[model samples]
Target: MAMKRNGKSPVSSDTDEKFMFFKDVSLGPHETQLRFRLIHFWEARNPVKKTIIGLEMLLIDEQGTVIQGFIPPGRIKKYLPDLKQGSVYRLNNFYGSKNKPMYRVADHIATVSFTWNSELSVLHEIPTCFDEDRFRFHSYEDFEANCDIKGDLYDVVGHMKLVNGHTLIERPTPDEVKIDTTRHIMVHVQSHDGPVMKLYLWDQAAADFCKKFNSYDNTPTLLLVTAVNTKRLGGTLALTSMSPSRIISTGSAQTRRLLIKQVSADVVTKPWYYIGCSGCHAKATKGATSLVCTNTKCEKINTAGVPQYRAKISVYDNSDQAVFVLLGDAGRVLTGRHASELVSSYFEANGSEGADHLVPVPEALISTIGQTHKFCVKVTQHNFSGDTRAITVTKILSLDTPSPTEASVGNDIAAMSEGATQSGDAVCEPHKGGGVTADEESKRACSSADPETAKRPRCEN
Candidate 1:
């Protein structure tokens, strides 16, 4: 007789919940309150059930809290395969590492989620080690042997040992800062073919990885390098060819360029190379353009005589769906796709619903961008002839968010936002395939490229 209370319907807004269940949550020691950006999270049941039943969310945070996000209770027991994939799934439970807290429906075993509770987070990330000739990874030494070692540097994969009990491994969130300045790093790798065999860090975040691996080297606790998808900055792109005395060339500045060579244990990066800009962010290409870093909005153009343009993106509406505002399409000439396609794909890989939930062409999808910073984007410059003037992504360390970005913006806008929450409705930003008005563009890109969500059924028409 009553699905109404205080004039509100039983089901409030999609995110709206009964005030009773909206209990305040707090942070604990050894457990900092973090903003987890859900990636791809899914669950399935036993013999009785057929398809994967639950949602697979990719949740990451800049506060070093990178892993799967909270799984609101009732979700474990009430999942339907046919349910929209991008639909927001939330739950309140103790997030942990390893077996215990995978999924607890009634304070009982969930049986469908990953075996992670407190001690070990799931295998959310893999190290970036691969060959330059092709996108294949050097997960094993054999993989690298096949690649023609053009220079003194060689690509090889093996177990990496971390020494300390609690070492600080860099969290490789897409929006993490790239070491903009060039520096020297120590490394140790076995070189048999004239010191040509180089060591590759599996992922960019693994840059500071130092752990205690049981002598064998296969320990899951041990950092596994060389077998990641090898697609982004952190993905084996920082390959440093080495010599017994000096280090050779560092990798490329282009986004999606995989790392080819690397140092294994304790080799150091040479003096000539710069760390590029912070991850997810971009810098100028040599002899092409030079610019200073700025927020996604109000980005400044420092490069002169070149077609230097910048894009400004913001999270809008009560939902705060992430959106980008590009200044020109010339940048697309370098990336081969239009500004909308490139920008859309960037968010698709980094957004909440990922590429699948991308809005229709010429329509930007309303969703989170990379990690916690919704406005993060990859920027490049081009000549008037449509040739690549330079390619650089512009983003900052997500760890600096909330404190730097939010603290400066103030309460009015922040208070009304979903507060790092994702929505299912597709908010379309009006965009033109060949060039349309900013108002005509939708809020998000199509989800055609999200790695995990491509074939997965999501909330798309």
Candidate 2:
């Protein structure tokens, strides 16, 4: 039988064999030929048993109709070798089965299932063309309408506003423990002229996003995610990734900048610094003779502990106020001195009691109480935990000129001068005479067991 080159013409031969369109297929066993392009495919698994169910696929026909396809495990080897994405194929003998009601990827009513006698062959030298791909996008309002329903899965395209609360332009160093534990990337994405929404890319989708995001010289602004499940988290609309989700990012880079006032250092509630493992910079556990790294991926066994700044300060703008946690070099950026310099200077002046000695909040941090600065904050999952109001500040931006590496996403804030001194609920006054003991300081600072909670310089573990 000779196949027709033009898609409009009926594909028939002398024996009256004809090609079937996906829209015309009905629920039943069929011995007909179906021609389509394998858009994408993945292994479907039993969620509970963690066993392979079958090879699931999204196939598109010449008429631009898309439908779900499946290859049973028993016959996978027969067609797996020849199965290639984006290649047109002729599938003979398939059972038309009812489509799943939930998490439906395509709009079809039935699925094309490969049977034992199915003959799958690539259709080469096709003069006619097929649609490259298709997407079903919903606006912020549309997503909110379907939130928590677990209905049909859809695609989303938007410009990433904030990645884990940090500007997308800044590539923060990856934390092994944080990545292993969280295992997700929460991005605030905004569609064209739409409200910003949170999208959680989990597991492989997160990994794929990271890989594609870093592959470019400049950060990509436009993000296209396929097969996302909409959810309502903490009374907020959230979109999460599924097993077959694909991430595609491209466009000019953009940065998310926030302008706020540094009200006062939150010295009474939390510590200003933490003794971190020198190797990985994670909170260290105190050993009998040495400090050990809490990060299991750290190569060092008994790594020396280094004091790192983790100062929490109350910050506010004209409208809202919240606590901001200064991690790593952000303290140095805000203050002219480093945590090590302040700690060493304090110890040098006052005799060393022990490693657990609490260091007072340096005057450098206190001096900036009423200052205003543009900050590039790194928002983490901890911010959404509802336990604390702390937002992680990754970098302190200069008001002069924006960095060449960063581009403005929206309206830029005007430069503001130093504001009047504002008193906060948790203010840190200078420690006079002798520093407080570890037990006294711990009692005052310890609010929650969360590691991100500010406390004095000690081995966290």
Per-candidate TM-score against the hidden true structure: 0.19, 0.52
lDDT of 1 by residue, 212-304 (tens): 122223322112222122121232222332211111112112211222133222222211011112221222233435544321321334522
TM-score of the candidate numbered 2? 0.52
TM-score of 1: 0.19
In candidate 1 the C-alpha lDDT for residue 12 amounts to: 31
Clashes of 2: 3
lDDT string, candidate 2, 1-461, tens digits: 44333223345544565878888777877777888898888888899998999999999988899999989988888889998989999888788899988888999999999988889989896545788677776656778777788888988876565667676546533343465678998877665424467889988788777777667776566677889999977776679999878875544232211000111222434678887767656566789898886555457899887787777666644334456667566787889787888999999888856756787778887567546677655343445554454565645767763543322322121111133111111112212322221111222111111222222111100
Report the C-alpha displacement of residue 335, candidate 1, in angstroms: 27
Off by over 4 Å in 1: 1-34, 45-56, 69-97, 100-255, 258-461
RMSD of each candidate?
A: 26.6, 21.6
